[model samples]
Target: MSTVEASAAASPQTGLRVRVQKLGTALSNMVMPNIGAFIAWGLITALFIKAGWLQGIFPALRDPDGWVAKLGGWGAYDGAGIVGPMITYLLPILIGYTGGRMIHGNRGAVVGAIATIGVVTGADVPMFMGAMIMGPLGGWAMKKLDALWDGKIRPGFEMLVDNFSAGILGMILAIFGFFGIGPIVSSFTRAAGNAVDFLVNNDLLPLTSILIEPAKVLFLNNAINHGVLTPLGTTQALETGKSILFLLEANPGPGLGILLAYMAFGRGIARASAPGAAIIQFFGGIHEIYFPYVLMKPKLIIAAILGGMTGVFVNVLFGSGLRAPAAPGSIIAVYAQTASGSFLGVTLSVFGAAAVSFAVAALLLKTDRATDEPDLAAATAEMEAMKGKKSSVASALVGAGRGGTISTIVFACDAGMGSSAMGASVLRRKIQKAGFGDVTVTNSAISNLSDTYDLVVSHRDLTARARQKTPSAAHVSVEDFMGSPRYDEIVEQLKQANADSTPAPAAPATEDAPVGDADVLPVSAIVLNGTGSTAAQAIDEAGALLVAAGAVEPSYVGAMHEREGSVSTYMGNGLAIPHGTNEAKTAIRRTGISFVRYPQPIDWNGKPAEFVVGIAGAGNDHMALLTRIAHVFLDKDRVAQLRAATTAEEIQAVLNAGE
Candidate 1:
């Protein structure tokens, strides 16, 4: 059965931490996806600015009377003038767009951009920090206004009202930004600059990591880099040709070290996934890839902190500094940004920080293995669950929710397809079967979630995000789309809610036999300590046992194979439910289930499975038994108990207990 990772419950003590993390994540979401823009800007600044590398490459470019003078003029004008405006104007607009989109969709984004223009124009420096703050706030206000006046507006005047309200709100916010927030922010920026100069003068640059590491993990790297560090570094670089401030948080070493540790010591899916993530992070300069890992185990923050401090210390000791910010935090970018005579120091800092982080992470992973193992296992199960779309009616019934019924349900995910599409199809079928034919079920990208849906379903990892997008809708979090028991619970609640008005459908003739009947799992059909190296082999073994008991025709095995080809039968938690399609109905001599337990897990598609249940039925005959089986698997410890059972009778007892 699929296991869910519930949303983390919040408490008063962690409130500050939670808020900081949320802010950081929001800022990161805005900036990280737009790394290409940052890269282009960084490259332009590095090559074309007054002290840029390009000037050194062709000395004639610096001579006004030389042939290359026009080239130098073009580079200088574009880099200093064009690039700064891009960051000043376009960056805030982009950030505003993302922040507004998060809260109130496209309309909010447009308003947010308009408001941000006020801040951008009011400040001498790029108004990224202001954009980050005002964009979402503006979007939120607009969203509330829209909701308050939702149906009050006349049908023919919706466009007029919406356009007027958004324009008015944007104008008000822009005026406030220019007149009020602008001067205050400018004063604060000056004060912050003074403080950084004090720290650098005292050689206390390493101390910045105390705040930087934690902030970076929260997704505030962009805000910190662009809002504070970049401006400070640019000033220092212009005067001294380099600034150590740029390397403080942009070093990829610490995150790379953490990922390497996970690749080496992490359990199950964590270990399996870390290697690929490490490559993307270390080479692609996408440090955001490691943020989730740090979030998963917050104590790892200590490792990042120490590593960052150590790297900064080394840079300070060697008088090492970068000429510009290293976009993407890749090692290559770091080296490219390094000034003359600083390569050795910068290289040493990277390795030293990585070593420190790896050592600490190794200890943490080892110490927390007991607790972390289950989460890793669950992640593995979730991965397997994403591969298929077949869900048994019985499994569907037991997995239903006890929540309030809704006429419209939307399945949301990061992307609109993949698991959400399959989940929508599964739930749609279950709803129809439960006599809720009039209810609408749909799938959508989480960003496109509408308030019109009565209920929204998403993966647990995305529950908070889904709520952020559609706060008005009831939300259900599921771990595995195909194997979630929540579906059964939801179906049950929906069925009851509509019972008075909607007529129940007649049961299929094949479901006449009760789920608990002894014939469903007769002792002769149970195989303990079974030997099979793959899912197909194990499934065939189970089918053989069923055939021996006169439960199915020999042709049923091929039918099961055909069904497996369409979609995996693996239901996760080391379990695979193998059954034939409706076309295989002629092969069923009797409706029964054959349970086979492998002594060791077998490869089922790319997933591992220890149990294979071969099912044969005429119409919906075996659905009741399948529901009971689903219940059995829902128990967290049931799979372990079944795996320990050495006898067919013991397995039989476990199956009966669920009934």
Candidate 2:
């Protein structure tokens, strides 16, 4: 989540901070997801450009004397011929598409792209910053015109009006971008470039990290990369064959160091997931993955700043630079982009930054693991909850009780394309399968959320921002986009509500009876007053119950442990639903759920758990059962009754009541 979304509830005095964060989120949203394109462009520029390793491999490439030179010259020729035009032509359109989509979806994207070409054509320098500004402005204008025309245009003239209006508006913006905005933006770019050049000449480049690290933590990495560094780096690379400006903000050393520290000293989910995150950060070139870790501990920004400064200082001392921008900020990409003589220097700078950051983070984490455990657990819970379910059927029912019916559902995130898009697609599929074909599902950036959506689903981290953006829309939060069990509960609720209001005819009974009392969860699976002090112990006892009932193999218990290691199974309200990982599917004999109640609450990571439910399913067949179980636990009355039950028979009766 962006700092703007995280600080939605901040005081009025922090308005500047909020605005800065919003700008960061918008700019980053435009560039981060498209890092792949940047990386591809970077590789092309680094491998085939005149100053690249191709010339080093074939020294005769620069000589105009022989046929060998002709073959070797192809690299530089292709680099300038193909890669240069890509940056000049395609980069602006990409920026425009992203910015326009953030404001008004596909229609806005079209107008934004059209308008951006005018700026790109008119300017000598790359018009990236101009695209960022004009793209959204054009999209917003189109959105306004669209809203104005809604319900007003005659049915037969709809296409005619839309086509004419869009064409006229686009043409006008293109002209304005060329004659009006282009000159002003170009002048500013020239001034900024001169200023940056002066800073680099004076050897004060490392000091820029004071601003860059904080802005990066707030999701301004993309804006800094494309809007500032890429333009400057391109100019420098053209003149000197390489530029240190590219590495200034794209370094992954600091983030990698912080993750390593977490792996060593952090508790709970942070420790467990840090190793995998480290590998992705260093190899995948995705620096955004570590933003949440920094956000969870804002004070850690100091470590990032110090580490970034150290890396820059080393680069300056070694006179190291890259042939092109290192997209995704991965170490491998950095090496790939490094100039021939700068490889050792760049490598040293990277590891140097990592070492500094690790030291600072380790000191902050300290030796007292117990003292930090609770905070780590809370952070882990918050992170997981962002991908977990946000709303219950009871809450949705309350909203529906007020005469509301969900006609539209919008999945929102910091950027529209990442998790929200995936979640929206998955939910749309499920909604269609559940027969709610009339309900429209879409995805958008959190900033673009509007009251038109009847339901807004987003990460829990963005719930406050979502509510602020679309107060009338019912909100749902989830941690994982692809595997949220909450979608099933939501579908069932909507189906039931639709059935109640539509007066549909009763359908014939089907063989699949929704996994209720008739199918599984007999009294034998219930264990009351179970003996367990820790979450793992409680889960083990529950899994044993499932194993004894022939619901799963003993390997299923290890799978449960493995899943918990990745993310806590704690479902809030003193309940935990432990299940095996996907890899453990072979251990399942059938779909079954076993419940064990611990009279004494056990610490499920940082959350307290009094009830442990072990789940084993052959496939997705248990999803319905999981949904029913969620509903049962979500109800205060049902949970209270289950807690008060004395015997396995009484627990069974409560479970049956929930069904």
Which candidate leads the pack in lDDT?
Answer: 2
Model 1: CA > 4 A from native: 1-10, 64-80, 147-164, 210-246, 258-277, 286-303, 318-327, 333-345, 358-659
Candidate 2's displacement at residue 263, Å, is 3.7
Local error of candidate 2 at 158, Å? 4.1
TM-score for every candidate vs. truth?
0.51, 0.55
> RMSD for each model, in Å, please?
19.7, 19.5
Question: Which pairs of residues collide in candidate 2?
Answer: 285-328, 386-478, 386-479, 387-478, 387-479, 387-480, 388-478, 388-479
TM-score of decoy 1: 0.51
Which stretches of model 2 miss by more than 4 angstroms?
1-10, 13-15, 63-80, 151-159, 220-223, 265-273, 288-299, 367-374, 381-659
Error of 2 at 269 (Å): 5.3
Q: Per-residue lDDT for 1-659 in model 2, tens only? A: 43222322232323344445456668777776666776566666665555656667877655444333333234324333555676777777788878888898988988888888888887877777888877898799899999997999877999999878878888999999998888888898889888977887898988989989877765545556666787677666655667888899988999989989888877766677778778878898766566657756767888899899989999999988987778768888898788778988899889999999999988887643445332332233233343233223213212432135666888886644324544675677678667677777787777777777777777665665776787666566665444577788768767765665553233322233243363467678888888887666776898898898888999988777666654456555677777776668889898888888887888665446788878777655665555555555656898898888887777766665533
lDDT: worst 10-residue window of model 1 = 1-10
